[model samples]
Target: LQQVQPQGEDVISGNVSLPKVNVRGVVSNLLRQRETKQGPERVGQTDSDVINLVSMLFDFILDDDNLPVPVKALLGRLQIPYLKLAIQDYSFFSRGGHPARKLLNELARAGIGLNEDADHLKKDMVFKKIQSTAQRILTEYEKEAVLFDELLHDFSQFMQTEVRRSQMIEQRTKAAEEGKAKAQLAEKTALETVRQRLDGKTVPEVVVRLLTDGWMGVLKLVFLKYGPESNNWLGAVKTIDHLLLSVAPTEDDAARKKLFNIVPILLKNLRQGLNSVSFNPF
Candidate 1:
């Protein structure tokens, strides 16, 4: 392995070097600038002026081209710890030559030196006021959160209820459609029997008996199942009314009267057969 050295003019070229005249020129220029700005008669300056002059010198050294080589080498070899110690020493000298006592005195004037109740009352009152204001704001916010939560909960419940209602309506509609389908099937069976009889084809005796008696039997079933209340009995009464309309004599009195007579007598005989459970002759 080989080590590569820096070859740039800024780092390796000896011609780009620091010189003694640059240091002297920078220091002298800083001193003259300070005197011109702050007045000529001030000789033994304060600690703040000394610090300013030192900072100005640091900037000038950084900018000068002909700085001293020894100074540049020393700055390059400086460690962070050594630089920090130098800064602390400078700061100690700046703070009235005694940083600890100056800091303590400032803290003391700011109420650190007070005994017992000397400052407690005012401090406690201010702290308590701040606490009370914070508590009031928290309570108001909590109440608002609770109100918002309640509103959200109510809306959720209302939506659920609407969903349930819609489902129930759908179920009822499906049940009604199924019931209509059953009734249509029963009507078709009855019509087929009637068609067979009119066409002079032999119908099973059981089917004829059922068609004649089943309408009255349905009326009786309705009455027995729902007779406890007047509203419940309304369906039975309606069935009886429709039965009378279907069998009643009409404007073709002669023909309709003959039909009414034949159907009623057939119904009387079928009623007896339907009353007997063991009379199935199909």
Candidate 2:
């Protein structure tokens, strides 16, 4: 067997000739773009800007580049409602900590495996539980009245696998790096590895997470669009926390306390006036 070396910016593989590549130029251009567009635009408080932001968020979710085919199809039934939810509060989707994007990205990234699991997973009891619960949440949202604790209870149950994954990551990190500094670096790498590898090994976990997270994203976008003036979703969410606190003397459910861990659920409706502009007119 004969091995061929690079021949003056060209490579020979049998009859095939590989072209020379400019790696540095590719990377430099990417960096330049990132420097210019690393964050969401600084949207103004103007009525128009609010409307524009809401419209943009709606488009972002449905655009071809934003979602993969299978995942999009799976949630297609809810897209219109989801967009309606977002326009009500665009601020929430813009932030992190919501599990919806993670679930969407995971399912989208799963490729053919997700489509294969669809029928089987939906048939699972856990999947049915999630579907029923999510539908209930949507109904409440439409009525403009949401039970904060109920949502969290469903969320906690659905996130059990994710919680276990977190614990596994922590245990693995602590096992390898007993020291603080090394532990941080190791945990970071481990998390990236875990996220990249995650997929629906079980039908129930996948369906539940997908429905829960998708709705969570929709619910969040509602606040981002409509609750900008309140400027404190946590404060709104804390009303529930305060109520639970008042009842803690007899409630006795320790897990209910975690409802305080939620981001605020603003009661304010989406701002009106579609003619308004969110971007700078000048």
State which candidate has the highest TM-score: 2
lDDT (Cα, tens digit) per residue for candidate 2, span 95-189:
57434333333333332222224445445443344344434444454424234345545556665765587689899898766556544543453
In model 1, the Cα lDDT at residue 70 comes to 26
Off by over 4 Å in 2: 1-71, 93-113, 124-130, 143-149, 161-282
Local distance difference test, candidate 2 = 0.38
lDDT, model 1, position 225: 45
Worst 10 residues of 1 by lDDT: 1-10
lDDT of every predicted structure (CA atoms): 0.39, 0.38
Give me the candidate number with maximum lDDT.
Answer: 1
Per-residue lDDT value at 199 in model 1? 55
